[model samples]
Target: MSNSEPQRQATVADSQAITVQTEHGLYIDPQALSAHLPALSYRDNELYIEDVSVSGLAKQYDTPCYVYSKQAILDVYQAYSDSFASLEHQICYAVKANSNLAVLGILAQAGAGFDIVSRGELMRVLAAGGQAGRVVYSGVGKTYSDIEFALQQGIGCFNVESISELSLINEVADQLDTPAPISLRVNPDVDAKTHPYISTGLKDNKFGIAHEQALDVYAQAAAMSHIEIVGIDCHIGSQLTEVAPFVAALDKVIELVQALADQGITLKHVDLGGGLGVRYIDESPVSIADFADALLPKLTELGLKVFFEPGRSMVANAGVLLTRVDVLKPTEHKNFAIVDAAMNDLIRPALYQAEMAVIPQQLPNGGMQADDTKTWDIVGAICETGDFLAKDRVLALAEGDILAITGAGAYGFTMSSNYNSRPRASEVMVAQSQQQLIRKRETIEDLYRDEMRWQDQ
Candidate 1:
């Protein structure tokens, strides 16, 4: 933590030199709270998560590991559920964002439904004890196989992105001799004020059906014997912090729904695709109650069953990717603390220009630093030159200190890969002081198991 201190080796020797706390004299800080990330905690200069110790977790699991506090996942799910408990909305967990069967199983155990984008994702939900009757299949290009799979599972409905997709679903369900329930994913053209790549509800984006065509599509689907018009849906975008766009999109969707009813095509559900944002940097997240307060009244007035496909908001901060410093280099221009993690492990900062709160396990002042004097660049151990995590970070970090990148529970490990042949990291979940390995660290043989040497035919 002390920049002036000579760079030390990243080992337990660095950890041993620290003085131990005395039980008689040491009193827990009454004001101690986790980093305010979902249900995470950063107390007493240490992370006690779900009753499990953070540093101890890294010791058992290894560096560049993802440690999820099990309780945080529950708390986040309940946050949305409680927000709309008085209402008749279904919180359908988006499986594509974080489809670890373990994570989905946990949510399913807590009575959560799913919003799947692929047949494989729908199968994952089913394998995790999620009911097909509660899952909603959503994607733009649903293949014949994908449609057949969803029809077989009897998911809640398909969010048809285009008219062609609706026809395809009708054919697939007709061939399979089943009635496919569907919802038109209408594009309201609302700007969700998010990254360009992840935004969905806009007309320009290749996601949902255009707003003008939604009513006609629904009417036609109602006439088809194989396809039943069940609902309407839209996902505005990801990491959205504003309530105005969603409120606007809601109005647009309701208007479309009313237009469909004028033609005698009444829908039973309205899947308001989820893109409610979370606090990642300086921005604050609108409370679930505020979102419900903003949109539920409109939904109730319209008299429709509501559905949500929240992915990021429910899991983003429920976990943290814990990495250890691999080396350090102090140049005249900047200090680079290279950790064992890489962009392949967590790409949000590199891909989205995302900013995560970088907290060193211990600083010179015992995790308290308000100095405007020192700055360091936290980077990863990867081959690519662009493999940096945090730029101009304000922490007075040294070579060996462990760092916890907050708000990584959702799109973090799910986006990681074995780039540069580096072994993918493992993941652990801690609940009530018990830490269990949810995912294993990849081995070289495991990576090459699917690969084979063959003579050219």
Candidate 2:
């Protein structure tokens, strides 16, 4: 007989058995990692979250499940609150962060306002029982419906992008017979030091009005009696970790605000759009307190109310995506592990090449074996060749195991699509000792809920 003992098979019953020696070699407290999931412990070569094991969640809820921790959400939100406690600020939780109604409702209950870009988002916030009066609308292309909705809701304000948009909003408000609160989304032209796809503060991006022209736009917006210039806004980028860019933008914005004040348009609020990054893998984001300490005093000194639209930073670590391994294979040059969750479910890896911490239901009895622990390209069953989650990941995993993709709470389900006619997954919110199914799993009919296939074609 071999010296090594037979390992416990990975299954729903074995969820807590895998002690996180290291989730992808990143040092994390096993307690903190499993604190949100109480019954989880490492033993017999597997992992478990409380009595309901990782594989167990897969069996009960099926694969490609989205699991959220209420405590984690509260903790992260509280972190932001604590960070900016010393300042006159309000965190308008970017509804785009995990846009799940339940998720939004959770944050809303914690007293978070919203920053919405689309009418659909506005509807979501409302449907989730979010307060509309506290919501602020931002984005360059605000459709008529979006404007009308924001006006009807009487949100805090709209971060307008252009002079034409300002005029259009004024016209809409006039026709609607309602005064629309507006703010100029200034493209501050500062290098946010972030990914290009998410960078919005640059001069060339299709996000905000040029900083040089912001004064004119503000002047024009101020003249419209139907449009009240309540604030000046700028979003440099998303997933940013540095404070220098924000300080730089604030310096420019303060100058403009001073200029506008000289022209008799005193800004009531200064909306510094969100770009704070969170820890996904070893990426070290600035502490919430540090960010606030850097930003709040600057705005407080200016004597203006401040608004922050944070998306990823608030909910990125609040939850994870659970998928079951379908198959595993090895070739001459590499290894492969196919999971049930597809790119259509979480697009960050494919869209932005973002890195995440991937953990399994249980690791093998032996420590990471080089040959067995090959660099696997984690893929999904989606039809597209681009339907991959991770490339060259070294994990000692086997078939039928569950893989927990970290940092999925924010953009995963929010960006999901039915790309190959695949049904969306269910989402569960874990609060206290109880787990609730906030969203039900999709059935075959859900896949065709919007498809009107008339046989006449």
Candidate 3:
């Protein structure tokens, strides 16, 4: 085929298979997979994550498992620390992204803090050896018990979202005879230009307090006997690709900070919340250095400690979902590669319509030819039609082949479910050549381990 010709073109075959022509050769270029995920590379035509072989992981610890690179996670965390080395800051890993105890432990050991949404997350952080003094409790729904537990544990701060939440925190603090350290999560009304479901700072979203009412809220908080206004927080959205929206949001937040300072409510810190996007496919996300460079000057001007709550950018590219192709059904219109992993295993594709990159763990024997490649809709065994991972991917695939779904570290296992009564997948962490089983695959009995029998009742 000519270089100017389209790389992927659809055609029907004798078996009525929908085949797609390759760019130049038969095999899918391994470089395509490794370019974005630096920790993954092909060795002897076999894909490997760090020094461990992908196929080896599947053979030893079954398919439908999550494999993460320990070094990759630390490298990303270190990059964040290095980028902001000139400032007094705290990188709080958002636990909702990947709450696996092992993952939390890895970050905690590396001198990282945590951003928790509930008391349960706080418990996870503590269980993973994360210090309570470094945990910041977020989320709009903080129950009475959640507040009591966090306060008792001596959490760093509470990112209070609403006026009622402020009152409740103050009440709980007053009852405990302690001052509750807080930061009013302000809604700057800046559009993050991300997915609607993940957007928060807009006026329409149910996140922080309104921008106009922020100063008044601060005043209300200052008068409360037990409320201690420590900082100001703003998070516009998640998976933000561009730096413009963040700078725009920060400008608004800077104005509010200046206004607060003018009102004699000087804050101790400012939390420009984390929404940095990662490259799942073709997206050109801003680098950590670039992101910090864009906002650090303003932050330095404020002369307060900085805080970031990054979740996806830290772990998304550090892991992959390893699954096995159980069957392949070719049709006249489209082909389906049924994998063992389902939406219950990784729900991003189903929930957010995300398109994850799926590549083979090993090349086909003797190398594949142009005719061997086919267009496939990589679907799961789940009954729902939305139980798919990637759509219209042209790859040389076959039965029993292991496929690695890239950019799955964050929100992969944390968001998994027991839908259709399928047990959750195992989690493995790899460092160089060493592999450790962090979480074992759930059993069929695990699905109902807490349920009671109707007859017994």
lDDT of each: 0.78, 0.78, 0.88
Candidates in order, TM-scores: namely 0.90, 0.89, 0.94
Model 2 Cα lDDT, one tens digit per residue, 63-82: 79988777777777788777
Candidate 1: regions farther than 4 A off? 1-35, 363-373
Clashes of each: 2, 19, 0
Clashes of 1: 2
For candidate 1, the per-residue lDDT at 152 reads 82
Judged by lDDT, which candidate is best? 3
Whose TM-score is greatest here?
A: 3
Candidate 1: RMSD to truth: 7.3
- For residues 420-442, could you state the per-residue lDDT of candidate 1 as single tens digits? 88888898887886888989999
RMSD of each: 7.3, 5.7, 4.9
Between candidates 1 and 3, name the one with more favorable lDDT: 3
> Who is ahead in TM-score, 1 or 2?
1
Q: Is candidate 2 or candidate 3 better by TM-score?
A: 3
